[model samples]
Target: MLSRSSFLAVIATIAATNVVAAPFTYVNERFGTVCTFPDDIFTDRQPEPDNGDGQQWLSADGASLICSGILNIDDDTPKGFVAAEKASSEPGYKVTYSKASKDWAVLSGLKDGNIFYERRLFGRDGVIRTVWIEYPPAAKSKYDPLVGAIAGSLKAR
Candidate 1:
């Protein structure tokens, strides 16, 4: 048998471990569209920086309609796009990258219907930003936490 305090401790541990907060939306920018999110995270980069693999860039035209607006990825930084993706719910690698930066973000009509969303941070020098993409599409749902952190750090213009 456990003492009252011990029992409470066990319950507290379980509760603490299970507790989860909802995901937040971040600043999203486009032609004339802009939005904000607080729970999300954002980070600053050198404009020309490398996450790990490919050199990150502001590119033009890709699967993501986002490129049509302010930023673009040239030779996309390795797993940079995953900033918009979450951990593998299915079974796969922790992260993957384009053999090339051509496909910054993609929504393959593979599953049934596909949807995408994004947020951007603006600046005077250029445009520092964070973008997220989703399927059923939402803030915390399938969104990447790393991206959320990066988004949280964004300095809006």
Candidate 2:
């Protein structure tokens, strides 16, 4: 038989596990994409009009942002991403990762003392999905993984 203290410890562990927040999947069927994000970071989400394609999430402190949207284009997915890149208005934009054939690209740069990371993916359905994550440069280590998760979660239907 287990000791009383041992049983209490096991109960505590189970309770802790239950306290952990579960992740949520945000799906936009109109754009044919799904994104998953942890429930801990962003505390508020509001629907925004993106010409019928968009969503936004705000961090608890409101210091960070995550947003996604879609744009209609006639070009193929790859070309659509390329065209979007060429049309970027960010001065001194630097591409951190890019794959034209994959129809995905990640670009980052410092703007107004804040680090801006943008991941863009073009779908075969003539819709382009873009995820933008902005946070202070000093918090890169903390936010980078979150950015990766949100971007990777995006899947075309």
Candidate 3:
């Protein structure tokens, strides 16, 4: 039998092990896009693309998160971007929910059987900052709650 204090200490250790790590901020140098995400959940950071657009991270369980920025060559607005996403013809791309304001747009739906959420910020610097996350439907309960925080942190630096 364990002493009372020993039992409490063991419980605390277990709880600490289960606690998720704090999020880490990622900033895109090329376009000044910024976002935050829990690095423990997205452990594998892929090589940055040669174009210096942004970064991609992958979870051990097949989920992915991408934080990127692109030149707003088309001079797109939030509303127009949302409309273009809805009309996208990419294979297995479907937008079930969408909202747009003057400076931001959000889209959420199924993509290739996985749940995907995307947020974009229209920056004054003629750049569009974006954060896109996708996870398996089976892990919705695990991931759905975190998406909002991740998306909320995406912005122009």
lDDT (Cα atoms) of all candidates against the true structure: 0.31, 0.60, 0.84
Q: How many backbone clashes does candidate 2 have?
A: 0
Which structure is stronger by lDDT: 1 or 2? 2
Query: How far is each candidate from the true structure, as Cα RMSD in Å?
Result: 16.7, 9.6, 9.2
Q: Mind giving the per-residue lDDT tens digits that candidate 2 earns over 23-136?
A: 566666567556665556666776667565767777654445554556654555665665667667877564444455576766666656667677767766667777677777
CA lDDT, candidate 2, residue 94? 45
After superposition, candidate 2 runs with Cα above 4 Å error: 1-21, 63-67, 74-99
Clashing pairs in 2: none
Candidate structures ordered by lDDT, highest first: 3, 2, 1
Superior candidate under lDDT, 1 versus 3: 3
Candidate 3: worst-modelled 10 consecutive residues by lDDT: 1-10
Write one digit per residue (lDDT tens) for candidate 1, span 1-157: 2334533443343334343322222223333222222221222112422322111212121222121134343433324544434444543323333221323232221122334344343433343343444333333332333233322333332
Error of 1 at 8 (Å): 28
Q: What is the descending TM-score order?
A: 3, 2, 1
Name the lDDT of candidate 3: 0.84
**61-109 per-residue lDDT for model 3 (tens digits):** 8899999999989999999988988999999999999999999999999
